[model samples]
Target: MLRLFAALPLPPEISRPLRKLQKDLVGARWRPEENFHVTLCFFGELRHTQARDLDELLGEIEAPAPTLSLEGAGWFGRREPTAVWARVRESDELRGLASACERAARRLSIPLERRPFTPHVTLAYCHATLLEDARAWTERHQAYSSEPWQAGAFHLYSSQKRDGGPSRYIAEADYPLSGFTAPEGMY
Candidate 1:
């Protein structure tokens, strides 16, 4: 069995700017820059058969690709600071893609999330001490915005357990966004 999900990977051009923001928040227990991504759906601990069926189902999906922009910052777990993340200003494209992924998951007999979708790139987790600092940094740089980027494709990822740390992720499959094109096939 493997833990898996579909997600949008951050492009280097976008990530470079975010990394600069990372530098400004010194002393915070930030997520490693490479781990940054916007999750579409998380499928935890599925059998190999399920994973293959999921990939096949996803391949048949067709939806217009949407452009996404990271507008600001937000915190989850207000009390203990479970996470710090960048906010996705509401976009119909993003919501549509998320809904499509959910439908695909349901068709494969995977459990669907009951919670509403909130799109954000998680920046840090497990740091109770970083809450105040995170809030402060967010206030100072709340105006930060990235150039709109294409959501050309989303991937299915496998998460592997790790000792004393966050789980590691590996891309299992990538589904191209309909009506979207990638430059140089980079993704």
Candidate 2:
């Protein structure tokens, strides 16, 4: 079985600043810089044939690339505070791309969670983080925002789990957007 998802990788200008926010929090397992991405759709573990089908479906999706930016920080799991994240500013283009990913899964008869899409880049997983500490950390970084950049492409990524480390994500296939030309000093 292969663990898979479709996501947009971040450029250095956005990711490098996010790297600086990984400190001053206890019980937080920080995600590596390489793992920083905005997931469009997560298709859990699937048989090889199913995975291949999904990949082919993903490649056929055609849309203009979305311009995205990180704004502020937040956490999930209100009671226990299970994770920390940097919020992505919402855009219709982004949502349309995400919806397209879902439609692909539906066509393949793949079961998926019907959660409302909340665009964000997960920064860390909380093991035993205190609620107060989590709130404070988010408060401190609430005003953060990165320069917006247009995504050139999205990818079908395969994730590999490690025994005592963060899971490694590999981009198995690249799907270029319909109309994307990087502007000066952006990509």
Candidate 3:
């Protein structure tokens, strides 16, 4: 089985700033710069057949690359924060791409979260039961913003444990967006 997800990579223009947001907060597992990505959909632990089907189905989606800007910070849990991340500015393009990915996952019978799309690049995972004043932590980084970057492609990524260490995410395939002009010096 493979843990799979669809995501848009952050270009250096955006990631450079996001990397600096990592902190040594108590019980927090800060994500490395290489791990920063805006997840479109996560379909965890798929059988080999399911993985191939997903790969083939995702290839059918062709849309313009989403334009994105990173800003602010927030956590996911109500009483206890699970993860903290940089916020993504809302755009119809981003929404449309995400919706398409979600639809593909559903068509494959992959269960997915029903939560409304709240796009963010996670910075860290709080390992404790709760982090003191998670709100204050987010507030401190509220003014954060990264240089705007246009995604050239979306990727199918595999999340796996490495040498019994932290989970590592590696791209299995990259799907270029239709009619989406990649910026100069961009991947």
Candidate 4:
């Protein structure tokens, strides 16, 4: 079985700018630069057959390309935090895309995610003594905001636990948004 989910991969241009903001935050257990991605669905482990069926179901989705923006910083846990994340502004396209993925999951008989989707890229997770300092650091640099970003495609990712920190991810399949296609003769 392989763990999977659809997500928008951040382009280097966006990631680079985010990296700078990440540098300003001190005392938080930061996520590795490579793990920065916006998750669309988190379909836990599935049987091999289910995985193939999921791929087929995902391929049928057709929605307009979505534009997203990262505007602010937020944390998951209040006192002893479990995760830190960058927040995404709500947009119709994004909500529709998320809804579509949920429908697909239901169709495939995959367990539907009960948690409300609050779009954010996790920045860090763990018990750290610098929570207060991290919050202050985040506030000091909260003005950072990038231009609207177009999400042309989303991918099914396989996640695995890593020794040093958060789980690692690998792209298993990619699905393009409506009216967008990969450059001719390329994968």
What's the distance in Å from true for residue 124, model 3?
0.3
Clashing pairs in 2: none
User: TM-scores for all candidates?
Assistant: 0.87, 0.96, 0.93, 0.85
TM-score of 3: 0.93
Q: Kindly give the number of clashing pairs for every candidate.
A: 0, 0, 0, 0
**Tens-digit per-residue lDDT, 1-187, candidate 4:** 8888888888766777776656544455777778899988888899889989999998898988888898887766567656667788778988898888888989987996688888888776646636676677558656767777788888888888889767888888899887654445547
TM-score quality measure for candidate 1: 0.87
Report the Cα lDDT for residue 10, model 1. Answer: 87
Per-residue CA lDDT of candidate 1, range 131-183, in tens? 67767867866898888888888889998878976678888799888888676
Ten-residue region with minimum lDDT total, candidate 1: 20-29
Steric clash pairs (candidate 1): none
By descending lDDT, how would the candidates be arranged?
2, 3, 1, 4
User: How well does model 2 score by local distance difference test?
Assistant: 0.93
Question: Candidate 3 — which residues are off by over 4 angstroms?
Answer: 129-132
TM-score of 2: 0.96
Winner on TM-score between 2 and 4 is 2
Q: How close is candidate 4 to the true structure, as a TM-score?
A: 0.85
Off by over 4 Å in 2: 184-187
